[model samples]
Structure formats: C-alpha cells, structure tokens
Target: MRVAITGSTGRLGRALMAAFGDAPFTGPSGPVGWDRAAFDLDDAARTADALLDRDRPEVVVHAAAWTDVDGCARDGELARRRNGDATGALARACAKRGVDLIVISTNEVFDGTRRDGRGYAPDDPAGPANAYGASKLEGECQATAAYDAADATGRLAIVRTAWLFGPGAPDFPHKIVRAGEKALRAGSSLWAVGDEWGTPTYTHDLAEALVWLVGEDAVVAPGERVAIHHIVGGGLASRADWARDVLGRVGLDVTVDEVPGSTWSRASTPPAWAVLAPTPLPGREPLRPWPEAMADYALSLRRSRTASNSTTRA
Candidate 1:
C-alpha cells in the first residue's frame, strides 16, 4: 500500500525507505520523502496536512522523535513537543483523513523492576524513569487518545522497540564502530555498560515488521484497547555483550572494559531493565541475533569505509 514516512532521514526511517522503496506492495506511491527541511516534526500542522490532505497515504510511519536521552532531561519542553505534541497532532490529522499511523517508541518506559530476564511485554504498564521515556509514553497516550475519541480506535499502532542496531543514517551502532576504530588506533579499549539490559533490533527487520503490522488485521477485540505492541529483537543483551561482539567481529582483539551504568554519568535517568518482549506469533521471521546483526553491520561499515578511503586516496 502507499505509505508516507516521517523522519525519513533518521535510522529507522531510512531503513523503512530501503525496505519499502518508492513502490511498496506494487504500483507507485506518488513518492514523497521528507527530512528536517520540509517535514520537521516541529511544523506539526504542515506535516500533518501534507500527509493527510495532500499525499493521502494509506499509512503514515511516524518514526520522528526527540531521542536525545540527556538533552531531553535538560529541555523537556522540546521533547514534549517533538515526542508528544507532534505525535498528537499527527494522530489528530490521521483521524480526520482516516489514515493509519504507526508510531515507533522505545522501551525506556519500564522502571527496571522485573528481573525475570523474560523482558517487558506490550501490555506491561509504563512507569518511565527519565524525561525521554516519559515523553514517549505521553506520545503513545496522545496517539491512542486521538483514535479513541473518534471511536475508531484501531488507527494508531504504538510499536515499542529497544537497543536498535543495523545500518542507516548515522546512529549509536555506527558511532560505536567509529569509536572502536579510533580506540584501536589509540591503543585503547571501549568501555561499555554491563548492567543495563535490553534487546537489540535490526532497523530493517523492525521496519518490515512495522509495515506488516500497519497492514495486519486487527479485530479490535473487546478490552484489546488498541494499545502498544512490542517489536524488538528476541533475546535480551547487555551493552557490553553488544560491544564485545562488534569489536570481536572485526578481529580487533580490544578489551571491552565492562562498567556499571553508574560509572558513566548522564543527564537523564535510564530504566535499568529496558528489555523489550518478543513480538507475538505470526509477527515476522526469527529476530536476527545481535551477534549476527553485528557481523552484517561490520560488513556494511567495511564497505562504506573502503568507499571513503578510495575517494580520499583518489
């Protein structure tokens, strides 16, 4: 079906573009993509009007957000606008145009209480500990409220994911790869948090699942509440584990000095247990293991680095 993706320059947004391309599900989509210039979330009304009134896309993948964890705590109002207000505005516009919206969220909503290692389910209550998490929770609430008020409650599907990896416009995984290269040249090792736990989702896989979910048959069964759904990778992993796999794959042989989250002070608080539960059956194919995903990412980095190196040499 025809779909319009917000924040089309960001990690998951670009992945959605790569996964769906210009002509998704056959035929043309009228092909429109926007970034900070024409589709800033700050311009909520314009963004909404363009998608709802002009493009009239069947699906609006809402991947834009103020994801700066520390900065969010510093200036929460911006986060509220970007995370909550913009989404609320988009949801309202969707309601008016009878379009479905897929809002991608994070797993920081958990309070880190559960230690069963089973991860947090979609039905789990959100008690966010940080400004970033709180703002996202607010966005989820607003999107749902918009649909609920109209009695067409299935329009918004909030997909909560976490520790996302895979290639796209630069993000944490790429940053770490760069840092690792720097550390290797500097004869140093990477320091990672070993205490924090979460699942790492591949961006491409997550985007595919979101596109599929936006097309799924939701019965809107009683008490179902048209609520959030978990779309993260299958297993839980610590940040150190993720780093070790990344560095090891490149044969770096560098030490991953494990440290508690406490050692690395931050402006915002993080939920100690931010793991995302597995997607329900009939979701997507097996979630790619973080190690395997890391290998794939490493290969991508190698290719990109080589291209850059060749250009520089030439």
Candidate 2:
C-alpha cells in the first residue's frame, strides 16, 4: 500500500511521519513522502496528474490545507482555492488512480451549534459559520460528489478531527506555551478564552489512525465511494482548562486567567461547540489525557529551547 502525504512539513504531516516510521505498515504499497516541491496542489490538473499517474499511490492523504482561520476571512477566494480546490483536485486524482483519498477535514466545517456537552455525529447537518469552515465544507462536498458520480472515483475517506496539538507545526498548545513564557517574562497572568469548547486530538494519534485507514481497502465500499469518519481526542475541554493544564504541567504557579470569548474577537466567527462525532471513528484507542499530553509536550519544548540556549551560551 503506497501512501502519499501532500504536506509533509507541517506539524500534522511531521507527526504522520514520526508515528508511522516507528513500526507500522499501512497502505497497499509502502509509505512514500510527497510534498509541495513534488507538486503544487494549487494547480488542480497538474496535482491530479501527479497523484493519479506520477506516484500512483494506493492511498493519498490530503493533509495539505489552508488552515489560516483569520486570514481566510480576509481572503475568502484564496481560502476556497487552497482548501476546497486543492482537496477537490486530489479527490479527482485519487478517483482516476483508483486509490483511496483520505481527506483530513476539520470540525470547523460544522457550525458549532451543537450543545456544549453534546457530541456531533457524522451524519449531522453541516453549517460552517466562517470562511475557513465554508471552504473545508466545500472540499467535503466535492470529494463526496466525485465518488458518488464516478464509478472509479477514488474512494473518499473524509476524516474530521479537531483542536490538534503536537510538536513541529506551531499549533494551539505551542502558541499558548510561547505566550505563557512571554507573559511570565512580562509578569502578567496568561489569559485565554474559557467558553469555547471542543475535543482535542493529539497529532500522533490522529496520524496513526490515518495511516491505518489508508492501509485498509475495506473502508472504500462498493462503487468506490468514499467514507467519512470523526477522530479526536478521547474527551472535551474548554480552551481555558486546556491552557491551565498546560501551564501547570510546565510548572507555572501563576494563575491562568480566563475571559469570555468576546474579549479575543476575530473577523471570522468560531463555532462555540464544534466537538467531533465519536460514533463514526471506530476502533481508535483512547488517547492519553490532556494533562499528560501537556507534560510530554512541555518538556519537549523546554529541551529544545534549553539546547538552543546552551548553544548560544557556548
């Protein structure tokens, strides 16, 4: 099972490499790395050609996406092309190649109308509120449509995950850790929004699942139709709680302050409760708790920064 990943440099992409390189075999053909230099996904036809014919990967993980939430609001057109267009092109490429296209979508695609304590199901109606979500939703539509229309439309596996955290890419926890350090230097309490809620997914765990899915031909059902699943961390928590846990793990005694979501307003509206659906994501292991995850992550950042500091001192 040959698996090709589109964005191999990003945080999630790096995590995929790390997790799978350990000792696993997924995909009909062995795993091979693919990234920007290989093919610019913005060019739909060229990208389609590369994925379908050039590499001929049995599974193409479309991890590349325009994930800039605020920037997306300012440039909706670019967002559409990057997130929707790039994803659609790859879906078509996979269809032609008769491979499985794993679309790593986001909870953002659903408008956060679900109650705070409740979880979303795969069949839940989607109503993305912001430009970012709208764009991803469009990708889902195109991906599924391609499969539904064509007999050999590459099998579609649209996996929705959320609140991603891990090393490499500057994701949510990394940003907060950087912020906390800066705030400590300034003698101020770290403040994060407390009201927003969603399940956090560890990048390593999600990558493992993606690779496993790619290896399995069973997911691509009759008609070569695509399958959709929701994969996230085992539980949910607010941004404020997540921050506090991270700070505590990092050995900060300073109280982590929480404020209403309105205080940190952005151009695009964030769904209040875009938690992932638990039902569709089958057989995934329960990820380590958020506190434990933060400890491991914090120490990694510390070790890296400490090494950098020592190098400068020398």
Candidate 3:
C-alpha cells in the first residue's frame, strides 16, 4: 500500500508515520508525508490541485485540521474553512482519483448529554456544542457528500477518537505531569475538573489501527463503502481522575484537587460526557487501558530526561 499522511508534524500524524514505518508500505519513493508547508489545508484550491496533480498515493489519511478548540470558538469562519472546506476539497480530489481516504475526526461531534454513563457509539446522533465540533461535523458531511456525488469506487472511513496522548508532544498526560511537578515544587496541589469525562487514547495504538484499516488484511463489510468507526482507549476517566493517574504513573507525590468543570474558564466548552465506545476492526482486539499506555509514556519521558541530562554532562 502506498500511504500518504497529512498533518505529518502533529502528535497523531507522528505516530502514524512511525506505525507505517514497520509495515510493508511505500509511496512513489517512500512513505508520503505532507506537513503544512508541503500541503496547506487552508488553501483549498491549491490543496485540491496538488493532490490531483502532484502526490497521488493509494491511500490518503486526512489528519490535517485546526484542532485548537478555543481558537475555533474565537474564529468560527476560519475553523469552517480549514476543517470543512479543506476536507471537502481533499475528499473531492480523492474521490475523483479513486484513492481511498481515512478521515481522522473527534468525539466532540456528540452533544455529550448522556447521563447513563454509557459511551457514544459511532452511529449516535451528532449535536456539537461548540464551534470546533460543529466545524468537524461539517467536514464529515462534506466528505460524505463529495464521495456520494462522485460515485467513486474508493473506500472512505471516518475515525472518531478522543483525548490522544503520546510521545514527542506535550499532550494531556505530559501537561498534567508538568503541572504536578511545578505544584509540588511550590508545595501546592494541582487542580482538575471532576465533571468532564472522556477516554484517554494513545496515538501509537490508534495509528496501528489505522494501519490495519488501510492494509489488505482489513475487512470492509459488504455494502459498506463509507463507514464510521470509533477508536479509543478501553475505559473512561474524568479530568481529575486522568490527572491523578498521570501523576501517580510519573511518581509525582503532588495532591490533585478535584473541581467542577464549570470552574474552568475557556473559550470553547468541551463536552461534559465525551466518552466514545471504540469499535475495533474485525479480528483486532480493543486498545489497552489508558493507564497502561500512560505508564509507557511516563517511562519514555523519564528516559528522555535522563538522555538530555547525560548529554548536558558530557
């Protein structure tokens, strides 16, 4: 399989690159990576042209989007253009060229009003509460519309995930650990929201699933050309719970103060119940629990710190 990944510099994109590195895949010369400089999503016309004229991979993983929730709330039009229009352009190009597409989406599309403590399935109704989620939902619509209009014989899968944490980026786990260390130094405690809930997914694990989706071994059910799949960590956690778990894994003795989600002021209002029930591909097991993945991330951080200290000493 010839695979191309957009947003090559992002946390998930980096993991996808690393995951595909071990697989029997290649582009014209090697694996195709399109960072912002190489493929700007904002310029829809140019993006479509580039995809149609220049890089023609067998599968294009559309991962580029304005992921800043607060920023999206501040500029809804920008979000719509980047996330919605850009995705439409890419999808149209892919549909026309008969290239398979894997669109990476978010769990924010749902309204998060479920009080039953159950995870949102892929087929659940979407009612975005914020500008970012609305924009992503629009993107999903555009992609589907494009493929439908073209009647293209290419596979299209929308993967919705949540709370991704991994190495090489300051993700949620890293942020919590960093804040906890700072608070410990100040002899204080860290504060986290107790109401907001979601599953903390690992980027590497999600990337592996995507690899299988694009590989020959993956089975697309009959009459299912366009499908949606929820790929997330095994269990769920509130913000405070995630914070405490991260701190504990990293050996931080700082206390975590559990607070209400309302106390935290932000431009975008995240879903209060953001959990997603992962629907793994057939024959593939669900991702491991988040705590296990967090342990690996903590160990990686320690190794990195140790290597940096050794280099400094040398």
Candidate 4:
C-alpha cells in the first residue's frame, strides 16, 4: 500500500519512517514524509489537499500534534486549534478522497480514575481531566464525525498509546538520565513521583504495530469502519519505578527518592492511573514488556554517547 506519514521528524514519526522503510510498502519511491515545515497543521485543509493531489497515497498516518501537555494547559485555544480543528480538517479531506487514515492518539482521553489498578479499554467512556486530553478527545470526535458525515467506506483507526520514549528526541528516558547524572555528580538523590503511573511505550514497537495495522496482515473485524485500539507497552510502572529502572539499567548509582505527584508544580495534571489495555491484533504478538524495551533504549543511549565522544575526540 502507498503510505505517507506526517510529523516525520517527531519521536514516533521517525520510528515509523524507519519501520516503513524496511517494510514492503509499494509506491513510486516508498513512504513519503511530511514534516512540520512542509505540512503545517495550521493550514490543514490546503495542505491536505495538496498532499493528496500530489501523492495520491492509499493511506495517511496522522502522527503530528501538539503533544506538550503543560503547554496545552497554558493555552487551551491553541491546543484545540492544533489538535482538534486540524484533525477534523484532515479527516474531512481524507474522507472526500476515500483515503484510509490512522490517527495517533493518547491515553489521556480517559480520566484515569479506575481504582482497581486495571487498564482502560478502547471503548471506555472518556472524561478528559486537562486541556490536553480534552483537545485530543475533541480530535477523536472530529475525525469520527467527519467520517460519519461523509459515510466514507475507507478505514479509520484510532491508535492510542502512552508515555512514548525513544531515540529521536530527548524523551522521558533522556530527561531522567540527565537528571540522575547531575544528581549523582552533586552527591544528591533524584526525586521522582511515586504515585503517578502509566505505561511507558517505545516508539519502535508502536511503529511496528502501526505497520501491521496498515498492511494486509491485520484483520479489521467485519462491519467495523472506525476502530479504536490501545497499543501500549505490555505492563505498567510508576514514575519512581521507571526512574529507578532507567538509572539502574544505565549503571547510574543515584538514589531515586519517591515522592507524590503533587511535589512538583506543573501546568498540567497528568492522570495518576492511565494504563491502557492492549487490544489484540490478529497474527501479531503483543508488545514486549516495558522493562525489556527500556533495556534496549538504555543500550542505544550508551551507543549514542560513545559515538558522540568519538566524534569529539576526532
């Protein structure tokens, strides 16, 4: 299938590019990428038209969004415009062109109030606790509405993941590693939130899953046009647990002090228990455990530092 990806420079977007490059996606040149500079979401309609007219891709994976949680909380209007309105516009354009669309979303759509420690399913009722979640929920709504309005037969999938971390950008793992090293050098301990918990996903794993979904391998249930799937890391982890694991994996000796989520003053209030139940896809095994994924991430970080040091010496 001819595929195109938006936000091709982002954490997940980069991984998706790598995965698609290896996969057997048929096109004039292979999967086409549109970065923020080339395909601005602000001009969603015009950009979508130009892309569809030029590329005529069979599928478009919409991965671009304003993912800054705190920043979204600061400016709800901006968040809505970028996340909500832009998604609607793109969905409408896709619907008109009869193109399949896979929209990337987050677990924050749920309020995360489940007390039994169970993860939220794809079809669960949504009650966003913050502006970021609210805006994303609106995007989901807008996409669904657009598809329904057009009565489009094309496939529309909402793939929701959580706590993404990987190689491209300075994600949570990078932040923790830097902070841990700093605290160790200062002869102090690193404090991490103990109460807040969620799945820590690796971008590579998500990219592979998305590839499967788009390929002929994945089976869309009969009569289901709009499907929602919670594709996340296999297990759950608290913030402190994640920090300690990351530090230990990297051989950092800094002590991680566990604290409540309220210890830090922030613009956004993340859900405390936002774990997502992984939806089973046919012919595909579930994603590996997060700790296993973290091990690979730690190794990558080590290699990156080694390469950087070598370059500096040269």
> Best-fitting candidate, measured by TM-score?
4
TM-score of each candidate structure, all chains considered together = 0.90, 0.90, 0.94, 0.96
For residue 212, what is the lDDT in candidate 4? 85
Residues 30-59 of candidate 3: C-alpha lDDT, one tens digit per residue: 567888877787787577668556876878
True-structure RMSD for candidate 2:
2.5
lDDT string for model 2 (177-282, tens) is 7788788878998888888888888888788777666554446545546667888877789998888877666665656888988897688878889687564434
lDDT of each: 0.75, 0.76, 0.85, 0.88
- Write model 1 residue lDDT over 130-167, tens digit each, in one string: 88988898888888888888655346778888988766
List model 4 lDDT by residue over 88-150, tens digit each: 888998988888888999999998888997899998899999999999999999998887777
**Number of the top lDDT candidate:** 4
Q: Output the lDDT of residue 308, model 3.
A: 54
Q: Candidate 4 lDDT (Cα, whole model)?
A: 0.88
Reference-based lDDT, residue 44, model 3: 70
Reference-based TM-score, model 2? 0.90
Q: Which model is ahead, 1 or 2, in terms of TM-score?
A: 2
Please give the lDDT score at residue 145 for candidate 2: 78
RMSD of each: 2.6, 2.5, 2.1, 1.8
- What residue runs in model 1 are displaced by over 4 Å at the alpha carbon? 22-26, 151-154, 215-225, 305-314
